[model samples]
Target: MESSSEFPTSPSSGTTAITNPGFPVSDTVLSGASLPSPPERTSSQGGGIPLSKTASNVSSHSHRQSFAENQRHPPPSPRTQRHPSFTQQAIQDLMNHPPPNRHQNPRYVGRDWRDVAVGELLQPDEVKWAELDMSIQEATKTLFQSSPNNVVLVRQDSSSKEAMSTFDHSDLNAYLLAVVGLAKPEEEQVALYRDISVKAQSQEEIPLRDLQPIFRKEELVKIPAESTLDKAIEVFGGGVHRILVTNKDSEVVGILSQLRLLEFFWNEAVNFPLIDRLYTIVLRDLQIGTQQIIAVNADAPLADALFLMSSEGLTSVAVVDNGHNVVGNISTVDVRHLTNANSLPLLKASCMHFISVILSERGVEHGRDSFPVFYVNPYSTLAHTVAKLVATQSHRMWVVESASPSPSAPATPLLQASSSLPPLSTLSPPAISPGRTGSPTPGSATVVVPPPGAITTSTPQSPSTQGPFSSVPASALPGAGLSGRLTGVVSLTDILNLFAKSSGLRPLDPSEQRARRRRSSSSSVRPTLDIGRENGRGSVDSRR
Candidate 1:
């Protein structure tokens, strides 16, 4: 893993001495927020995954298992000394890149969501599209080579007379599609959607439209181009992970994403501190503390896992046993490699099946049993949050039950029955009853429950018992192979949202507020650090 010292430094700082390429200046100091004392950095063996604690004289199979786990999450080894303060050059560099058109620039300025218009930072051009009749194989190729966004917009073939008009407001519903990928540990490939079918022994071309998942208009999170950033944040905090920015015509123009927003705030936090002090804040004081835990069963089909992630706009999901104990976790990246040219089962296979396959392929008995899981107590400080993200290069961490009823007995596992959903092919057509216009109205689709034992998952034991996974000691696995009940999740996006809502950069004065109002009347105004939100007008308007 890259050392924190290796973190990229701002290019603007001229006077700050360069210690090394990745390390920040060690002795530089500034003033404003009360910075906490730096904690001693410890060295671990893996990058993100926890290591297995096998006995030194373990079997060759145990050695291979240990080796595989380290490959996935290599422990860290200390490389550089910790820096005590921000360099003068770094501070000066930040000052030079002042936020556009601010009424006042303080040593620390808290910016609000309303100040910037959605149009200014909009990225409509990033949306990738495919033809309605395009083959799933072709779409997968397009996504792997050119698109990084999660969803693909499917449009009618250009050869048709009305191809251009197919993008009209009404057509938005028809174009929404999500891609699914591999959901097992140790497995890696380009990502593809769950509904795309590939025969077990042969590659068949499936129509992209056939695999498109229909989501209702109301189910989507959207914000007007004229809405404030705070409004976008409001929607995000309300459980909408991604917000589609629409114009006056209600056409989707761009997307305001949680991850991107969080990244922006993290950059600001590093650059815009009012004082030299590292601000001390805890999760209990942030918005993320109140979020409810969302998890999936360990034996759920890989397709279901992908659907939940794409619909909720999450990068990862926690895997829980029937007792609600988190057994593992799967992220978008974990499943990304499934797009490989190899013939592998996807939609119909359970997550455990994928893990088992990966293990078998790697000559390891079972990798899933030892997959690393990390958790943080809700009351943990933001400092620790930043530290973990940096140290592990991970996207998010789980908030687990701080105290368990019994260490021997794991916390309540997710009910095994929850994994009973069938492959996307078997899911009853979304319950879109016919409407007044004689067309099916786009809305919630109730899935028909299958009979008991109809949908089954692979058992915890591997089909092969001769492998090393069988001989490894139980203590070698993460959290003793049992996770506490999940309480919440904190991602890089959540951290940024908290910072955007909390960082008090500078207060707006009456005269400055009046100037803002005057400017807003003529043009869109970016948010400033104004706390007043009286009478629902918000601080951006005339300070109520």
Candidate 2:
């Protein structure tokens, strides 16, 4: 909710003006090849217990009558049941007398979720590591080089065996705050902001251990490898981003992220009828995610946006124009670009320019504009949202007001079900120019202003201009067509939490400790120990 007007537009002693380059469009297009195909349905697979035809023929009237009869004479408890396995018996009971609206049940529909184990969803490659004494610059480079694995476990020193903390993109906010001198006393903070060029030079030498007060070094959530998927869901629903999987010896085995679990649900949805059905429900009907949005103006200094994210404990902030329309997005992940010495001056650039530079850098590095523009509207289906998240490899989606009018529901609610899962390429709407009234056409070229007293060039530039501080047109960007005001943000956590809630699973309270379950003596399935050690820190080479 911070406004651009609250911050000064230019430095007090310098005549250099921060010019507003039009919004840069994201050029990345999602490809379906990356998404796993939905697995074929089978009776025994995915915890599905096939019901007999006779059982399926029972009408709702008889179901209600049976419920009343059960109320009069309650059935025998599990202890007295014929089935030896309590879990099997419970699943049988659920299958025999399904809830009228299975969506309301605490268990997954058509599947015995207890059969799924936490080890099945873990990706060993995601485990990266860093040392406490490593300079922020070196750590930043390590994190960026690690790619998809955004977090790294931190050790106290090279000789230490156990990880003492964690460092991720979110921690970059604290580093940025230090660079701008915002962590200093209020009297000294103003002077630091006035001349950021001098302060940026000193930040690289600071070590990771120096920012311990602001770093999210809390104990990583741990779960036994043998634990059920439902337990993982419960922990994830509680707002934990990733959980470390451990073995009987209490050593780390692997890591499970919220995105990985969501991907599991997405790829295997066909086997779980309830989850598959839930996917068709539009975001508005489910009422998932928070509407309390934290954002910054497109013209605000990139440093200001990072400060807002750091102070508010947010991973990303929506960039909006004076009219409140979402023009761009800035997240902690983008902070990786600032670690490069040449890109450091961008801290003083406008957020819009920062986004432009990011896209340009990515376009050059990847040989294509691969940074996706992630946003959704009320009418977007849960399946669409999940697909986009997985496809873009992003953590959240900005909820924007739909440019079109709301559609009326069909006579049969089930008819609203999507015939097929929409591809990620279809999620991005057409690009529309973003800014105050009378904005340029979507095809208009980006305008870049030179530094004070710099000579202006007369040469015409291409639509896809590349530079350290130049902007690109909407036509060349992938997500430029997402037009409307941002309403809220739906993160991977929000989506996972919704699934947990619909399954009747309660979120683990902060005060409650997650009990780690041990592998049963009767089971012979032993999880493979895949934890890797490298450079005196634990790490795994990720296939992603």
Candidate 3:
């Protein structure tokens, strides 16, 4: 990947008005662009007072013209108007007409945002691949082992070399749902699958092809690798989480995730004065993200949180307690823990307990607590938020109210455990044994593993015993001192959208687009006025 300092020179500056090819012109006038003139009307057509006609005739003619003109051309509907501001127009023009020599320009300098290409910032694609004939167990293992924890399934005999589908956390959720005998009824599953019936089965023997219904076959959003960063931002502004970077032949070369984009911006922020200014603004002043939060109770079954994620189309959900304090977080990525035979029973564990187990697993597997609790307050600066997001590799940060520290109490780390739950460092490694089969029955004993060096009790403790916030003191819970009540959730998408808006290129609202489409369809069916000359006379004909 190209470093921030290696970018080429920005496009030359000028007052030259350039046409935007692919981007839709917004409903407001762009800076430096001429305002469009209103539709033309004729006095003879009754649009204005007829100078050659009688007073009575003029009155009636003007009324008719006004109605006809209004019907034919509505007065600059917001959907049809062009509203690209000066900054947006400049960015679009830059993208439409780039310099001939991207690297050799005499004025070329490092870290010029305008000259950066999506391909220049793209990192190596870490996505793994699996054959359709691969067993679910093998595929799951491969997926978890991969960095991004996703796999592309392809046909062995296919000639196009295109991926048949993708398998990710969502697919794992479905498979696990079936394994636990909690698969949705056939009627409810209709929208998810076509013909295959998913049922509780052994992952070791089932080929991925048999579970085609669970594969994500949605069309992958892609962009040309050579496209400018502005174009990528435009696509992302439409709510896409990531886009596949494609080469000239349309073959996907790399993936640009929301996190990766933000990381790049954070790294190169010093080079761009505008971005640096944006970073200093507090989140409350910008009000960038949605206030509505979708969360799961910390005491709810871990599976419930995963199901909620799948249903709500969320990558993660805030795990909160009864008072709505964010206690922890659970994400689709955590589903990887279930692939282990020893961890399968955690499906029915409380979300908090499940979180503890996953944290412990991370320490054992990766030698540290990979999952860190991250939160920010409304007063937090955008720079702080971005720094935390990039540092933790988290898609979001829980926005909590700023808590007033007590004079008597000393400050504690954000991840500090309350008396109810043991500290993460004291957790021991989970005991992995062989011969585990089928999903654990209800009321089965769930072993909560602590990190190495933790004291273990002789008697095995259930997940409920391990950690349930109901009995814990409020003052002892995580975020008790440094954070307050949960207010909202800010995500990577929100930050990216803000950047796009700052450039005067606001994301197109889906609802507005839908309304525009409706109006267009309706107009196509409406009668249109066709003017023609016949028999040495002018006539207006209404045609559908």
Best by TM-score: 3
lDDT for predicted candidate 3 compared with the true structure: 0.51
Tens digit of lDDT per residue, candidate 1, span 448-527? 22222244353232111121112222223333344455667677555544544454422222233223322331221222
lDDT of 2 by residue, 280-324 (tens): 788899888767665666655566677666554566777765434
Give every collision pair in model 2: 25-477, 26-477, 26-478, 27-478, 106-503, 430-481, 431-480, 431-481, 432-481
Candidate 1 at 148: error in angstroms? 5.3
Q: How close is each model in CA RMSD to the real structure?
A: 18.5, 23.3, 27.2
lDDT of all predictions: 0.39, 0.52, 0.51
The C-alpha TM-scores of every prediction are 0.44, 0.58, 0.59
Off by over 4 Å in 2: 1-111, 157-161, 184-206, 217-219, 403-482, 509-544
Q: Clashes per prediction?
A: 50, 9, 9
User: Which parts of model 3 have CA positions greater than 4 angstroms off?
Assistant: 1-114, 148-160, 185-204, 215-218, 365-371, 403-482, 510-544
